[model samples]
Target: MENYFLGLEAVHPSCLAKIITGDKLPKKAIIWEFTNEIKPIDLYCYLQVKYGSPNGLQNFLRNDSSDNLIHWEWSLAGQFGIVSIQGHNFRTEVHLIGEHDGKGLTLEDFIQQIKADFKNHGKSMKSVRVELEKWTRFLNPYHRINSVVAKNIKSLNSLDVKVDEDRELVKFHEENLPKLEENWKYVRDKYDNAIGITFGLRSMLPVLAESFINLIIFVLAKPEIKKNERLLQNTIRQQIDIRVQSLHLNCIGFTRPIDYTDDVCKKFHTLMNERNDLLHGNVEVNKLKIGEVYFKGKVPVFVGYEDMWQSAMGISLSSVKYNTIFDDHAVVTNFIEFILDHLSKDLKEQVQYIMTNSELGYNPANGRLGSLFSDNIADFRVSVNEA
Candidate 1:
């Protein structure tokens, strides 16, 4: 039950003051700062392990390379609120407020969680501790501005003018820091709704795909069901008791089933296997190889890990081989497109409505989903066309 105070400013102090004063909509807030000892990619992995793919309850996302920041918040059923990791040059700072619920974990607990997650991922924890210690030093009350001024030294350059201004600055920071915390609730809610769309699609794609298959079965079996109503009804009830994959295969077989060799279906099957692996806790990182020079030390687990955190992806001793899955977000997009291309006109409209309603579509879904097929799936279609 330790108290954690908000610290530092990424934007100008005056701009932050304006935000606290409600003169401007605060574009962002600061939570923690660290030198190059801690990398953004490590933070990204920490998030993936902690929250498991941005389900709004514990959602997070990294910005583009230009921004080089990760935006996320403590979302344990309304515990901690919005937070951001801002990186500039070789330094990074996590900025956030403790406004939402008093039950959020203390700063020490959160730091320990990171250390544990890092060590569990087969990485060293000593470096993590060193960087965290720096954060503690920065936040130390003994070294605070208020304390420095209290023990006035004659060597201070602008003694009279600066001291008076410093006192007022301290007063301003104290008065408005709590006010900024309250204002951030609105900002956090907006990001949560947007992240929810991506999360929902990932979880719901398989169900939607199965629904399309079921529709196909319903249409094809209509004549049989009509002819032998009682018998067909019993058979249908029995079929419903089977596994989803079997049902999907049976429905596909009834309709001109796409073969295992077909590229789209092949990819879809691979995605389904990977999704099942994830759901069942069988996910693993594929061993890393750099050209002819084999590296047994490293493994690629998450989509961006190979690109961002190569060092942290290493295994000190053992070698374990595993199959790779496309990024979960990529899998969702490809799966939806696969279904969209096969469904009937009336069915397509229903699928569109399901995905694009105010609940899912309120934030990012409309623009993102609309562009997904056009921008991403279009390329796949081009290769098929060429073939």
Candidate 2:
């Protein structure tokens, strides 16, 4: 908690004259919800005019290039000590801070007083009728997909190793053949699950990449690019490869575009092709070559064919291995990094913040103000005295 009182010492003389010091800190608070129709700045301006210059006012802003307001605090005249007023996320709260001795203003009393003031000042402070709704766009889906892919790979590896161990046991003792067969069943089931999960990853990775790049352009693109709806739509609708390659040059005026031949760029295009194959239901199948031969007492029991035949279809997803998924995931991450690296320092930092935080703060007028992380909230003042 920060001692906002320390700053109050320098308040204007007229406001300071009304300030009162108390032995006990204020504990009671009254909150009023406002419709989004009213902006926080408008209410703050009104308070400034009504109470003259406040003892202290602080604007808590987003930690991004936008510098949009997250919340604000104003210390005004108080009968007890200093009354604190805060506007945050479409709500205003007034805190009572002084020695009341049971004779100070009550909650209802202050509510009526504020209501009258609003009415006299020609302000229509409407109370919220419905619960506040919050919508968040999570930016870390790539990371989540990577996690699922990793877990699937780990499960597959464990099943494969078990199957190999069972085969070795069967070789030593013919009676262990049943165990080997059972382990093979486990491997088959796991393989089927992996195929399905990997297919989803393949489909989503490309889409996530496209969404990410377009999001960057939408949020941080040059003013002219943003203002023209048609241009913005056309740019976003372009082939993902074109968007990825041109992101730097199109969004930032001077940076060089990523070369199509760059390894990262090439990898991204390959991922897109794989996604396209899946989307278009393109199938390719070739005769699988048999590899290892398993024998049961001079009788061939099992013959290992290439892994491709086991795929859901002859689709490219059939060739996906754990390493392949890892590489594809890396391509998206690396390409995003490459694009961000070419951005100006400030833009890079802002985009990085958006990517790192899970929840985006919404402003009706601005769409997205920025993100707010739990740690950022933890560091902020929880109460007026801590402001």
Candidate 3:
């Protein structure tokens, strides 16, 4: 395993005066952070055009295998440094390595010189804008899917009431009930369709919640857990409840575990049970009752029957109501908020910003100014470059 150290904070253009005071360059690599307006790719392209290929004295080499928009190397004063833009969160960094003969010049002067060079020669790169637009298009479908689900649930509830009313009318008119088989069949068909939608939505809710929870883990898991592929896989494979509880320990390092008594946790546990019952084919039989009917010209008829209705199997689809779907969705949101509440102020702010705006790209206005770094410096170079 390669040893790693925390690199010096990258001097942002705005903080140069206060931070970069001395001529002595940092012993460790200095990570320079940039905004979306000026991405590392934009800088790379400009340098490529100005300095040609990376083979020359002003070497500029791009890692074609890297998923990051800006995973490249540029030689400044004969020393190679990495310039990378993280794909997951669009956090840009230029890791300055080794030393330069700045003589009496301070680090501030060197940064100013680089900015001047870019200002004089660099052209705007469309990569950042294009990537943001692509993400926007990707997210649009999810919004439409959620809207359709809500609309279908509303329709299902309305149809459910009608089916119940039809059943009641058929029971009261027992003599004509046999003759109304076609009407009953038609009603059953409509009921089946509406109820099928609810079942499908119910099954999907747990899946969506689980996926989101896994996403949070992926984003916020401790460095030790993330770096060990086997450990990460094991953690993910654990029960959903375990994974949820582990978030407090692994990410936030809280000695106290997440409170299962909380409403959010209660809802999440219910969703997990539902998902398990569905996947494991746990059939729960529900009894349905019909009232006794009296005839006008004959002895009163009492009709009673035993029926097996499994909610998970859609035998009792009515059991999975709109509120169930709503509650399942609410639990995911609530659980996210619940976890956020436990995080430190800085971590909570960063995590919230990343969760909300990562799809769109990083926006400094929403939270902390610079890129969020993991514990391992090598991770800064490699993990962020992966898709």
lDDT to native, each model: 0.37, 0.57, 0.51
**Tens digit of lDDT per residue, candidate 3, span 32-82?**
555564445555555555443332211133334323344443333322222
Candidate 2 backbone collisions, by pair: none
The sequence of per-residue lDDT tens digits that candidate 1 reaches over residues 92-132 is 44445334234554445545555545766544334443343
- TM-scores, all candidates, are 0.25, 0.58, 0.44
What order do you get sorting by TM-score, best first? 2, 3, 1
> How do the residues 73-181 of candidate 2 rate in per-residue lDDT, one tens digit apiece?
6665444456666665535665555544355445455444544455555432232212223445454543354455556546545545332453344342567566866
**Model 2 CA lDDT for position 26:** 53
Error of 1 at 107 (Å): 69
Angstrom error of the Cα, residue 204, model 2: value is 2.5
Please list the residue runs of candidate 2 whose C-alpha ends up more than 4 Å from where it truly belongs after superposition.
1-45, 56-71, 75-82, 87-93, 99-108, 123-197, 219-223, 280-323, 340-354, 357-375, 379-387
Give lDDT for model 3.
0.51
TM-score of model number 2: 0.58
- Selected candidate, larger lDDT, 1 vs 3: 3
Off by over 4 Å in 3: 1-186, 253-256, 283-315, 318-333, 345-387
Candidate 1 Cα outliers beyond 4 Å, as residue runs: 1-195, 225-256, 277-387
Q: Which residue pairs in candidate 3 collide?
A: 10-31, 54-60
Instruction: Say which prediction, candidate 2 or candidate 3, comes out ahead on lDDT.
Output: 2
